[model samples]
Target: MLDACYDTSVVQSAVDLANTLKPVRGEDFLESVGQLHDFLDDHPALGPVKPSEPAEQHAAGARWSLTEEDLAEVRSVRETVRAVLERASTDAAGAVALVNDGLRRSRATPVLRVGDGGWRTEVVSGTDRCSAHLAAAMFGALASVIATLGPNRLGACAGPNCRGTFVDLSRNGSKQYCTRACAHRVSVAAYRSRNNPG
Candidate 1:
C-alpha cells in the first residue's frame, strides 16, 4: 500500500494526476495511475501496492466520457498543483486558493471544519454532489504527498527539453529529471555534447 511517505508511488501519482490533465508523449489517462502503481509494486525497495483502475472511463464510446471542457478543467487544476509544487517556499494560502479554484471550477462548494485535530473538507453542494467528496479525497492525498516532499524535495524537471515539475524524494536530493527515461535522455545528450561539440 502507498503510505503517506514520499515513495515511488506517491511521486508517480502526483505526476500522473498532473499529466492526466495534459498527458506527455505516450501516456494514456486510463492506464497512467495503474502503470505507476505497477512500477512501485515491482520495486520492493520502494513499498509495494496493487494498482487501482481509474473510476472513470476513457473509451471512444463510453456513456460517461471526459469532454474537452473536462480536460481543460483538469489541466487547470494540474497547473495549479504544479505551481504550488514548484514554489520556493511552502504556500499555504496558494494551496487553499488552488483548492477553492478547483471547487469553483467544478461548481462545487467545499465545507471546511476543524475535525480530528485539523481542518477537514467536504463538499456542501455541486453538480455531481459526489464531486466534493472526490475533491476532498484528492486534496487529502496530495497533502500526504506534499508532506513527504519537504520544501527542498519539490522541484521542476531539469531535463533541458522538458518543463514538467516533480517531487524529488531521493535520499540525496539529486533527482533532476521528471522520469528515468528523461534522465537517460539527458545523459545521452550530455554524452553527445561531450563527445561531439557544436
Candidate 2:
C-alpha cells in the first residue's frame, strides 16, 4: 500500500510514457535517445528513488548513459505498461499479471522516504539500468493506484481518434478522455452529428 499523499507524478509519468506512442494517431514521441532523455528530464520522479542507493550516493553529476539498448528496453517496458493500463478496466487479472511480472523483472522494491513534504512510498529497482528503474516506478505506481482506487481507474481515452492512456486520480474517478481537449473534441463531434443527422 502506498501513502495517500504519495506523489502523483510517478503515476502520471506512467501514463505519459504509455501515451508517448499514440497508436490511434500514429504518433510516437519517444523514438530516439534524445527523445528518451527529454522524457526523463520531464519526469524527474523516474530518477533513482532510493536516497541511500549507490546511484544517488555517487550523484556527482553522474547520469545514466542513454543508448539504443536502453531505448529498446524502455520501449518494451512501455508495451507492458500500456497493456496493463488498457486491460486493467476490463481484464484486471490479466493486468495484474503484467504488473506483477514487470515488477519482478525490474527487481522493484518499495521503500519509504521522508522529507519536508512528508513521508511517501517509492519503488526502486535493484539494478542501475534506466529501463529497470523506470519500470519499477511505472509499474509500482500503477499497482498502488489499483490497490487504492480499484482497477477501473486505469483506462484509455474514449476519443475514437485517440487511444491515449490515463490514470484517473480524480475524486470521482470519472475520467474518460486522456485530456480535456480530447474530451471536448469528442463532445463537439457528438453534438454536430446529432444536429446534422448526416
For lDDT, the strongest prediction is: 2
RMSD of each: 9.0, 2.7
Alpha carbon lDDT of each predicted model:
0.48, 0.85
Q: Global lDDT for candidate 2?
A: 0.85
What TM-score number comes out for model 2?
0.92
lDDT of 1 by residue, 1-198 (tens): 223222344345445555543334544453333443333233232111111222222321222233455444444555666665556245655765664565465554434544334554433334432223233334444555555554556566777746566766556777777789989998898999999999
Minimal lDDT window, size 10, model 1: 46-55
Off by over 4 Å in 1: 1-11, 21-72, 88-134
Tell me the deviation in Å of residue 142 in model 2. 0.6
List where candidate 2 sits over 4 angstroms from the true fold: 1-5, 49-51, 54-62
lDDT of 2 by residue, 1-198 (tens): 334744688899899999999897688998999888888877766666444753343331136777999999999999999999999999999999999999999999888877556777778888878899889988989898999899999999988888899999888899999999999999999999999996
Query: Residue 135 deviation, candidate 1, in Å?
Result: 3.9
